[model samples]
Target: MSADRSSGGGVSRRQLFGVLGAGAAGAVVGAAGGAGVALAATGGGTTDASGAAASVYPYFGAHQAGIVTPAQDRLHFAAFDVADALDREGLIGLLTEWTDAAARLSQGLEVAEGGAVGGSDYSPPTDTGEALGLPASGLTITFGFGPGLFTDESGADRFGLSARRPAMLEPLPRFQGDALVPEMSGGDLCIQACADDPQVAVHAIRNLSRIAFGRASLRWSQLGFGRTSSTSTTQATPRNLFGFKDGTANVKAEETAIVDDHVWVHASDEPAWLAGGSYLVARRIRMIIENWDRVQLGEQEMLVGRSKGEGAPLSGGTEFTEPDFDKTGATDAPLIDADAHVRLAHPTSNGGARMLRRGYNFVDGNDSLGRLDAGLFFLSFQRSPQQFIDVQTSLARDGLNEYLKHVGSAIFAVPGGVAEGEFVGQALFA
Candidate 1:
């Protein structure tokens, strides 16, 4: 082994956490007429009107931080497939290494002490140098285990962990209008890296992918910008490529009771290892923006069931006002269209189930037809996969589906948070 890693030089967790906001101190130094120091030191004690925390979120928590943390501006989401040559122990080793790296990176420190520079010049650096001068920017790296992690497509227990798989962790059923590409969907594991800065988010995924060099390989990845949902009430709802305010009715982090009921896997739930965990569903929905742009604004609003200006229900009232599905217009027809997205995706229409969504808008350049290959990269967390299933099934009739195509999809069992001494998903291995 090389002294580069075997020498064991890195910042300690206590030193990292107790430093009065060491994570983002660099970025806030001269902000807000010097109030930046307090903001940085206090782990973003100051908040704007939207209630968005200005900096740093603790990496260690009861549940993973990213799901409920205020939505960040950018995302780098990557899914990985375990290498066939890697065994169960190698998987555990890779996870352990990833946990340590995640803790350091989330705190705005390098992967190790020598980091991108200080180490011997003879060997490759332990941490990539791209993020050397960046702040934490509220970066969070969340891990998940997909169905194939435990068992192969042939149903062979690859890691001797098939018995521990969550019952709902199966591959998602194909729904209506699915034009999924095989290479773009599914993985044995996944990492979601989110941050206010695009480079910081990319750095996280890059380093993590490097760490998994031999154990696993990237299956698919998506880079997204301009968050499409707000996970906290303090954060304003953001719009998608379609230009309507999205996630107005989404579950907020402040709604503790609702979160417990709808987002987290309860202790009483089956599979004790995933007690505090949650299930995640990711979908790549390519929007037909060209066609959508040609539709009259009023017609677009009708399909969404909200005013284009204020995102208010067409039936009347403010953006936050509960939608009225039965209110009729002058022509004696319902104000909200029968197949409106708001009506179909609403909790009332989906067995009272809700998901904590933290999606992003993506523009992956252009297609062969000269159309912009852009859309929404949808991400949601729920207590069970069935919640998403029901909601998506109801969207079978959504008017918005005509302008949208489901291109990629995957579901993962996100295990509970890591303890100080434990690696992520340690309980599963135990």
Candidate 2:
């Protein structure tokens, strides 16, 4: 009950970085401290791994609105650079490992008395996410593997699981060489596990990373979304990031009929495995909580579709509760701010299409530069990026854009899952 940031047998706050666990914002901690340390652990010398770092990422989710939110906040993300030699054989081995790891997480693991596994080895975070207002997240774990993960044919190894294709997002202003976000940028990690108990999340990720990458290295981290529940929520959730319940505006798979009519495109060109999969990951987010908290309790209620304490739509009820869009002038009354993020991403407005969002907040180190780092990794899964594209294009011009910034971005074309010994995109490339 003590902050829950620490579990019962949790490692002393001392070990929160390595052996303990970092949060979504700061997980990028090195297995030791900086990327140099991480590189050293995996064979320090650089091997002429260079390329024209693309100035613009294709189909990035930067400007895309987020559907998942703080209530859905318990999450972690890790991005890794895969060792080369990833071919049909490597993919086979990789997927097999995924199936195995998924099995263990689904069943649960031996949680340390502190709720995390004990005796694990990792350096301590030089700093907890003080600027971010959240204690380091406990259990959440996320995964990312670089492009080489799938494309590299050499013996280079991967750090974790990856989306395998480029993603698209609208670009934002660039950072000077000293920015912290460049450090928090994307790649791949093995898994993302969030939970009520930080210890449970740590325990889950530690084992999950061990199994997926042989050794899980810390990378990028942060804490967000405060929830009343044990889930240790963060602003990463869909609703509150923009100061309102965000994802309620999204569409679900079961509601595919409606989605097909609006959001999705089942073209004859696409193959079968992608049939059920939808494209377009909308990631509209903001940090109005600070502002919301400032408003009179009653005023906050009228501004959002839900209540502050309950998180339910203003029409009535508790969190995870339904929103009453039908409250007549409630809609026209602009009870919800006109420029509010929720107002932009709603189904009645721009959310006619939906993307499966899977991302976490990130908080990296502060250097001689003026401050620390903060923002969301904001990821989405869709059959095509188009669905997400339309929604984001709408938000890019909305009111919520003031607080949030579209920083790092990239677009990856995820290929189909492989069959026996085939690399993921063997059908297209081979």
**Candidate 1 worst ten-residue window by lDDT:** 24-33
TM-score per candidate = 0.89, 0.50
Q: Model 1 shows how many backbone clashes?
A: 2
RMSD (Cα, Å) for all candidates, in order, is 8.0, 15.4
Candidate 1 lDDT:
0.81
Kindly list the per-residue Cα lDDT of model 1 for residues 1-430, writing each as its tens digit. Answer: 1012232333355533432231110000001101121222112323344322235667766787688777788889988888777788778778888888898898888987788999898777888899988777778899999999989999999889999998889999989879998677998999999887788888998888777765677788888888888776666677888989999999877787888899999988979999889999999999998999999998999899999889999999999999989899899999999999999999999889899998888888888999988898999999999999999999999999899999989999998887786788888988
**Alpha carbon lDDT of each predicted model:** 0.81, 0.37
Winning candidate number (lDDT): 1
Query: What lDDT, from 0 to 1, does candidate 2 have?
Result: 0.37
- State residue 376's C-alpha deviation in candidate 1, in Å: 0.3
Q: Report how far residue 69 has shifted in candidate 2, in Å.
A: 15
Instruction: In angstroms, give how far residue 239 of model 2 lies from its true place.
Output: 5.9
- Which stretches in model 1 have alpha-carbon errors above 4 Å? 1-54
